[model samples]
Each structure stands twice: as structure tokens, then as C-alpha cells.
Target: MDDWRSQRIFRPVRWRSRYGRAESGKMHGCADLPGRMAMARKAKLGFGDQATTLVARGTRVTGDILFRGSLEVEGEIAGNVTGEAEAGAQVRVLKEGVICGEVRVPVVVISGRVRGDVYAGEQVHLTASAEVEGNVHYALLEVERGARVSGKLMPAAAGSGGDFADDAPTPGMPAAPK
Candidate 1:
């Protein structure tokens, strides 16, 4: 590492910019260098790190998942999913995917099959060909034409607001409340 202080004061040194400059008798305002580094470290996580992860087609996972990041499911998952409790967190199940367990997340967009309970804190979108046979509790919901939902629709329990509020649906025989 180049030690800024060890350099001769009379020698020319490149300070702020890439261009060279003759060193003066006193040090420049480089004293804030450490603070600038600290500031950069505290900026925050960017959109890339916060972007949703994907489970592509033909893949399968058979265990409970407690993910702290967003996920897009295009394969098969046979376990409980307690997703990250963050804004924009979502689980998108593609037409080829199948999930067979409980899923508690902020947003759920399903175009496949889910044979378990679902609690979406924000919204749930079920596209055509989506077949769900369990309980669904969501603040907002949308189901496309030809979608099959054979389960109950129940109101979410009070207290937990950002997911994890188990709201069992009433019964599959009757249409769920819109």
C-alpha cells in the first residue's frame, strides 16, 4: 500500500484526481478519507442484492425453507415456505411448478399448482391453469379464467401484519369471498 505520509513533502503526488500535483508543505484535506470510506460502507444494499431469486423449471426442493430474499418458483417445492418479511417479496409459481405446503409471503403469483395453505400479506394472483386445494388468506387476490381453487378462504388473524397470519379458508364447496 502507498503510504501517503511516507512520501516526501516536496515530491509531486497525485491527490484527488489522477493528474499529478506538486506536494505542498502541508497535507491536503485528505483527512476526510477515512470518513468518506465509512460513509460509503453505510450507504445500503442495492437493487441487485435485493432482487428476487428464482427456482427454475424442472427443479425440485423437498424441505422447509425460510428464505430472507424474494423467490420465483418455476419448479416443484414440497415443503413449508416462510419467506422474507420484506416489501416486494414474492413467490411466482410457473405453469410447470408445484408447491405442496404452507407459504407465508408478501406477494404470491401462482400459475401452477399449490396443495397447501397460503397467506399472502399483500396480494395473490392466480392465473389460468392454476390449481390450488388449500386455504388462502390474502389482503388482495386475483384469479384468472379457468383457475381451480378447491379450498377455503378465511380472514387473516389480527396481530401479525407482514405475513405469518394464518387465515384458513371457509370451505372448498362454496365460492370464496371476493
Candidate 2:
């Protein structure tokens, strides 16, 4: 008897977008390049090579945090958050997140409320939902429409060798004397 599996015709698989939308069968096209690049960047940023540490919602952290890879905050951080400058590290603050102290990282993406100074060695992206009450220091800064900043936006000096202390005082702390 002939096997039924041998009689069946193979059909090409169709891919879907992240939201389950059907996509055209074209492998690569100029029309799809931007979306694909954005997806790739998002995936890379969301899930990096190093470990990811999350501060879940409804939680509160009271002390300084020193991390190497990625840190996503959905709750509240009451102190400084620092990351390695050479590790391509990133810090993301969610919409419900709040940081009452300083943030120092290579990359920072904020969609919440930050009440302190932010220092990014590489870039800082402030989404539409982001609200900053203090200054921002970055090599590259992108502020989306509707993002609010109550303080100064300072571009990091070129060839300054990554010193975060030359800017200003930490939130709720005394300024450093010259």
C-alpha cells in the first residue's frame, strides 16, 4: 500500500508579524527593511547577550544598583542605578516605573518618571510617556513627541573620558564643591 504521507504536497510556510498579522512571502524587500530593522533592534535591546535584571511592579528598591548587562524597572528605584560603560549596558524604565535618584548607563530608555539626573554614555531615548524632572546628559538623545522634561538637556562633552560627576548633584543631595 502507498503511504499517505508520500501523496501529500508540501506547502510553503507563511510568516506572521509579531502581532499575528500575515506578512507577504517576499524574503527581503525595501518596503520591509525598516520594519525588519526596527524589530531586530527591539529584539536586541530587549534581550541582550548578558543577563537581564528586572525590578517588577509594586516593588521598591532603596539602595544603589550596580549591574553589568540590562536592568528594566517597572516599580520604583530610590537610589542610583549604575551600569558598565563598556558593556553596551542598558537601563529601561517602564511607564509605571519611577526613579528618585541618578541613572548612569551606556544606554537608557525611559517611558516613566525620572526625578534625578540621567547620564548615558552612548544614547538616551525618551519615549512619549517619559517625564524627567532633572537634567539629562547623553552623547545622543532622542525625545519623542509628548515626552516632558523639566530640566536641562546637556550633550556630553566629546573626549571627556566618561566622568559623570562633573555635571551636577544627585537628586535630593548636596552639590559637590569645586
**Which candidate leads in TM-score?**
2
TM-score per candidate, chains pooled: 0.62, 0.65
Poorest 10 consecutive residues by lDDT, candidate 2: 4-13
Top lDDT hit? 2
The local distance difference test score of each candidate is: 0.75, 0.85
**Candidate 2, 60-154: lDDT as tens digits:** 99999999888999999999899987777899999999999989998999999999889988889999999999889888899999999998898
lDDT of 1 by residue, 29-86 (tens): 3554677677766565454356666778988999997775578788889898777765
Give the TM-score comparing model 2 with the true structure, all chains together: 0.65
Candidate 2 Cα errors over 4 Å, as ranges: 1-49, 161-178
Q: What is the RMSD, in Å, between candidate 2 and the native fold over all Cα?
A: 12.0
Task: List clash counts for every candidate, in order.
Answer: 4, 0
